[model samples]
Target: MTHLKVGDKAPDFSALDEQGNRVSLSDYKGKKLVVFFYPKASTPGCTAEACNLNDNYQRFQSLGYEIIGVSADSAKRQANFKTKYGFQYPLLADEDKAVIEAFGVWGPKKFMGKEYDGIHRTTFIIDENAVITDVISKVKTKAHSEQILGD
Candidate 1:
């Protein structure tokens, strides 16, 4: 559900992470970045995806990639989720959705035959120069690390 595609320049964003620390796209200059947007914190699918990335944190680190998760959850909720799961990366508490909308990941979604507006689960792999190298719209939560690292 993202309008962004491979080779598109990643939209710039400056938002607060779980700890209320300011995070911005500029912070990751000269580094490969994985920005994964999830529907909610602590949900089944989101948990699996976040944990999968956490489990492979070292791999990403060794390969010079930094991971960040984004959701519309409150800072408290994001902090709780991170602490509970021991995630090694930052989880953006984008309650304002500035980053979400900038990336175009929020839109109509369906579940259990019900339709509503929500954040679409998506991952964008960006190279050091800020160009998107890949956009994983159909995320495989259980194998997300492989999806990003499967060169």
Candidate 2:
């Protein structure tokens, strides 16, 4: 679970995108941003969530929202995932977990009765001024766009 809340200030971060481009929070200073963190790239749940968002990319854009995906995957893996899905937004390759940790999404997780540490899937909706407006901890992968859109 995330320590960040709806009214909290989004933590600043700088990381390399799939294309190895340096991206930072400041880059989106004047735009609404959807920063979603997933446990890994190319996984079933992650794929569904990402694709759902991409499928409604135009809707989000028309509503003045820019989306970005993040995971602890490498640059090559992130690139492959983006290319495979034809995602219109950038996917950050947070190999070092810098951005992940900064957002407090990296923590203990359990799967199939096994305990381990991993990135917890989470999403943050940020306004143009960089304040978090919503935090979705229980993400619904297939209907994620609706979750974000409140539809």
Candidate 3:
């Protein structure tokens, strides 16, 4: 989970998107942003979350929120995942873990009784001024959009 909370100043960072183009938090400075950090790209859980957001992309747009998915996946892998799922949003290829660390999403994790360091699936909802408004630590992957937007 993120150490930063609501009203906290989100760290500014930059990374390559799936297309190898540079993108940064500053680009969305004057816009609402949904920056979600996931462990990897194309995995079942990740895909479910991304697709759920993609399915509701227009709804988010109408609500004035731009979404960006971040993972430590390579650019090629990110591109493949986006293409396979027909996602409308950009997926940041945080291969160097810059964004992940800046957001404090990279840390210890456990699965099947094993422990290891990894990126936690978390979402930070930032307002127009780049201040975090909501942080989703426990994401409901399939219903992620609903989790963010509510009923």
Candidate 4:
């Protein structure tokens, strides 16, 4: 599947959030969304990115945006990550990779000369109408939320 681009309808998906609640993209309709995909739950870079989002969460809320993080981790792990990092947003469990595949963030990646398939750190900003407004495929962990907010 091709990666989603700006102006395209953001693919709708439903997944179990950290709290075991069923959350769907359509549920957030009429509201802007920042949907981010990360590689793992508790890794350094992922944690940093999530924390940055947590820190700027109020700013995002003030801008009328809801933020969600997606990863291949289980709901339990996601809950732990959120609790450990004090993240105020929902972290969706994409153990089946359905949501990740739909967003085209699940793919092969190389690290330290090793090739593996995983979630590529990426973020998508969707407008209230569900049209994608911006995509950040190459994310810098520490500045992720800032970049998204800027866009």
Query: Candidates' TM-scores?
Result: 0.98, 0.98, 0.98, 0.96
lDDT of 1 by residue, 11-52 (tens): 999999999999999999999999999999999999999999
Q: In model 2, how large is the Cα lDDT of residue 46?
A: 100
The models' CA-based lDDT, in order, is 0.97, 0.96, 0.93, 0.91
lDDT of 4 by residue, 95-137 (tens): 9999999999877889999999888888999999999999998
Ranking by TM-score: 2, 1, 3, 4
* Runs off by more than 4 Å, candidate 2: none
Q: CA RMSD for every model?
A: 0.7, 0.6, 0.7, 1.3
What lDDT tens digits, residue by residue, belong to model 2 across residues 43-151? 9999999999999999999999999999999999999999999999999999899999989999988999999999999999999999999999999999999999999
Order of all candidates by lDDT, from best down to worst? 1, 2, 3, 4
lDDT, candidate 3, at 119: 95
